[model samples]
Target: MRATSIGAVLSGALVLSASAVTAPAAYAAETGVVIQKVSVNGGKPIVLGTSQTESFTISVTASDDSGISSKLAFLQIKREVGDNYWSYHGTPTCTASSATTSTCKLTFKLDSGWGVPRNTLAGPWKVVVQLQSKDGDLYNNGGDITHPVLRRGKLSVDAGPEPVAKGKSLRVTGKLSRANWDKRTYAGYTNQPVKLQFRKAGTSTYTTVKTVNTNSTGNLSTTVTASADGYWRWSFAGTSTTSAVNAAGDYVDVR
Candidate 1:
């Protein structure tokens, strides 16, 4: 994952104030720690991309009946957007195997690109966790496993008339965005329902060549006729606060 931990903590200043929705500060269970489950990404609702870097995977279940320890396993993430409040913290990799139970499989990421500089501010994000035990015990709360649908989004495409002539009529455009973070970018994702793939130059697979709906602003035109000459993309397949996306294969040249 070494993208430099995706900006292990890139920030000169973020201030904090996503309008509200902040919850973090209420720990004092005498420090014995016991979180049982916390699954994100796998729980679905993640499709962030302002440029790249989206390696998702978060699975944690901690315990410390005064008998589980061996370092630390943390993953604190928060978000707001509007005013600010976009935090990050990750250590990942905790395992007690079974005894007192301690399991973690963290690999979370949300890089805004520019070499993992993390510009921060995307959408819903909240996964507080901290399981440290080496006699200094400390396990923050996440009780019901954070929520807010765990959303994230960002998508856009534009496979145009690079060179169509075999049968003419090869017009495909796109833009079904999502991800505002108060206005970090991408916003047109209105009528949803986008999918129009095709791959055939050297074919590896990609069939669907229909289904289009995204107007009012999400834009996405349609028109296909030329045959053979592969590559073209646009797939959404995500709902529940946006997630799925596929746009990066624009190559057409049927002559």
Candidate 2:
């Protein structure tokens, strides 16, 4: 049988934006079918950078006494209640695990040019799924799943005074930034905590020296006493809307 896309089946679907709604777990309407599991991007947040498109797969595992239907499923990741979403326009491929259970999967692509809103927030978005059983039982959820989308972060660090007298003061400087989907550029990620780390020469591990917060322009700076030759770098733990980042180590010489 021909299958209808979830977006088509629920033309007036009213799932709210991630920022506005907290949806409950999806449950089948009848006892004939049960949705056992759902996974998006392998349960990892969808992260976007300046120019590359992200491709992810969604899988839905369901079971029914009457067996599952083949190639009759749809998946949608909605940014809002309306037409703004990443959808799998084709039929999902269903692989049966047992006579009564099957897992349906589909792939989707998200890029800057996909007609999605340029101002879409980098937090939780909703996942909507639809499926049918061979016995005619159907399952359609109203944004029952939540997934995160985040901006990719970048960090830079520079330790000044390449050669310094032992026990002298050394300076470290850096910047923290993240991808701005709307502008397609890297913009400063201000007022975030960043760790300044140091590794003694001949050592393979780095230890945190101090924590500094970025300024209004996402610039970071700090002072430390030079003890030994080593490398310096900055590390950001990341926030809900941004991905974690680390700057390359900058070498310093203490004479």
Winner by TM-score: 2
TM-score of predicted structure 1:
0.36
Candidate 1 local lDDT, 4-82, one digit each (tens): 0011111212222122222233443567566666766555444454444656666666666654564666776565655
Question: After superposing candidate 1, which stretches have Cα over 4 Å from the reference?
Answer: 1-39, 43-58, 61-65, 68-77, 81-97, 103-126, 130-136, 141-169, 179-198, 205-216, 220-231, 235-244, 247-255
Candidate 1 Cα lDDT to native? 0.59
Backbone collision count in every prediction?
A: 2, 0
- Top candidate by lDDT: 2
lDDT of each: 0.59, 0.71
- Per-residue error (Å), model 2, residue 200: 3.8
lDDT comparing candidate 2 with the true structure:
0.71
